[model samples]
Target chain A: MSIALYFFAGLSAAAALGVLLFRQVLYAALSLLACLLSLAGLYIVMQAEYIAVTQIIIYAGGILVIILFGIMITSRLAGKPMQVSTQYPVIGSLLALLIFCALVLSQPAVTSHTSDFSTNHWQRAGRWLMTEYALAFETTGVLLLICLIGAAVTAIYQRES
Target chain B: MSPVLLYLSFLLFALGVSVVLTKRNAIVVLLGIELILSAAILNAIHFNQQFPDRMDGQLFALFIIVIAVCEAVVGMSIIIRVYRYYQTAVPDQINELNER
Candidate 1:
């Protein structure tokens, strides 16, 4: 299980780098899919089963498709690789590395303890969402509705000159 | 286990920040934001593992995921509108946001 966790972590990191490195929008979108899937796998390894499933269904299935459609519709570089302009790669990388090192150095040494991975994550999550988090869940629904309407209006505004 | 997980999430978050900083394309910028959001989800779930019975972290992660989807939808629609109007999706070249 730990080995699987490490494997998915590496895969996700590599795919995330691909998302950063790809010069074309389509390629970057594809890399994002890979990253999301690997992250889902990592979630499963960490006993986050419901989150893993949600990650796959929502991120890989839904969001990725939306991004791909956006890429196809908005960009005129169809069938041709469009060069994405990236500035200050060296400085950006240096800053990121600094942040990474700081995070690593700040970590306290692990206290050895056996993790209890009993399988009620989904049940409890559902209960809390329905009970304690019911208000938040309803708010999310409202937000989603607003987003849907807003997106449609914005996309179809069709300003007349 | 926790230390390694924290490190991975931090690394991912940093990479996402770099992508946001360096990429000029609007879609790529959105992708960077998504990456950062996912890194945060990973952290939330990791913390949840510490107390498996309490579902607050996982529930919040789920909420974050939903919000992220909504964000991406709205952001992509806006990007489409920008592309239609300006005929390009590169942020640096879009002068509409700049003060004249």
Candidate 2:
């Protein structure tokens, strides 16, 4: 588990760096895919198989595809494969380094307790959703519908008079 | 709760912030936002591992994923609209609101 955790963690960090350094928008998107997938693997190592699966399905599967489509369409509109440039690259990288250092230095020592009994995460999550979080669940559905409608309206190309 | 995973998320967050700060492309900026959201989700998952009995962290992570999905969709749509109007993808170049 430790080995897998370190591997995924390293992969995710590397991919995130690629997202920052890559000049091609396509390459950056691909880096994001790698980062997200590795993070999902880390989730599995943490013994949260349900969240891992959800991460893979929803994030890697759904969101990544949508992003790729957007990239493709936008590039087509520009009549060239999309490329990227940077502004204040040095300052931005330095700021990020400072932020990371701050996070590491300011964190308090952590203590974790392992549970003796293993629970069925899927069943338990479903039960909680249907019972304690029923209202939130329904509200989420409504929110998604609203987002779909809002996005469609915003993106629709209407000739502005 | 796990320090390793927590550190990893922190690293992701910092890198994401840099991408947003430096990148000129709106799409890349959107990707940076995704990275930031991912870091937040990782934090929730790490906390879930810490307290296995209380599934609040897991539940919050799930809901956060939904919110991120919405954000990405809307964000991309807005970027597309902006590109159409400005004929460029860089956020810095969109200066219609700026006094000439």
Candidate 3:
């Protein structure tokens, strides 16, 4: 299990790096899909089956599709690989590296305590979400509705000359 | 296989960010942002497993997914409108609003 956990973590990190280094938009999008799917797999490895499924459905299935469709609709595909300006490359890379190092250093040392990854815990999560977190859940729905209306208005409203 | 998988995910995330930062295409930038958000979600779930008593990480991941969808929709709409007015989707080319 430890080996599997480490493997998933490394895979996720690599995909994240791909996201940061890829030059082409389409390839980058594909890489993003790969990253999201891998994250879902990591969720499964972490014993969060519900999160894994949601990650797959909402991110890999839904959001990725919407982004791909947007790219298709925009028709801004590049003919050549985009170039990064060299003026601040060293500073930017150093900053990113520093942040990554900080994240790694901040992680708590792994302990020997092993959790019993079972179905009961999942049920507990469901109950808690429905009861304790219900308000937040409801608010999310409202937020989605508002986003939909706002998007429609923004897309449809024409500017007057 | 596990290490390989984790490395792969990291690579994807880095590539996505690069696209978002370097690409002139607005939609591509949005895609990159989505990739970054998913990376954060993955990290949360990983930590959640290590501490099962709290389901906060998973819940947060769920919320992040919802927000990502909302951002994509609204972002795409904004991009469409920008394209309609500017006749181009390249960020560099849409500088009419910039003050000289």
- Using lDDT as the measure, the top candidate is 2
Selected candidate, larger TM-score, 2 vs 3? 2
**Model 1 over residues B2-71: C-alpha lDDT tens digits?**
7778888898999999998888888899999999999899888877766655778888899999999998
The CA lDDT at B38 in model 3 is 70
Candidate 2: Cα lDDT at A64: 87
Report the lDDT tens digits of candidate 2 across residue range A16-125.
99998888899999999999999899877776677789889998999889889888877745666688999998999999999999999997666666554466778888
**TM-scores of all predicted structures:** 0.93, 0.93, 0.81
Q: Which 10-residue window in model 1 chain B sums to the lowest lDDT? A: B46-55
Clashing pairs in 2: none
TM-score of 3: 0.81
Q: Is candidate 1 or candidate 3 better by TM-score?
A: 1
Top DockQ hit: 2
Task: Report the lDDT tens digits of candidate 3 across residue range A97-122.
Answer: 55445555554544323468555767
Work out candidate 1's RMSD over C-alphas: 2.0
What TM-score is obtained by chain A of candidate 1?
0.89
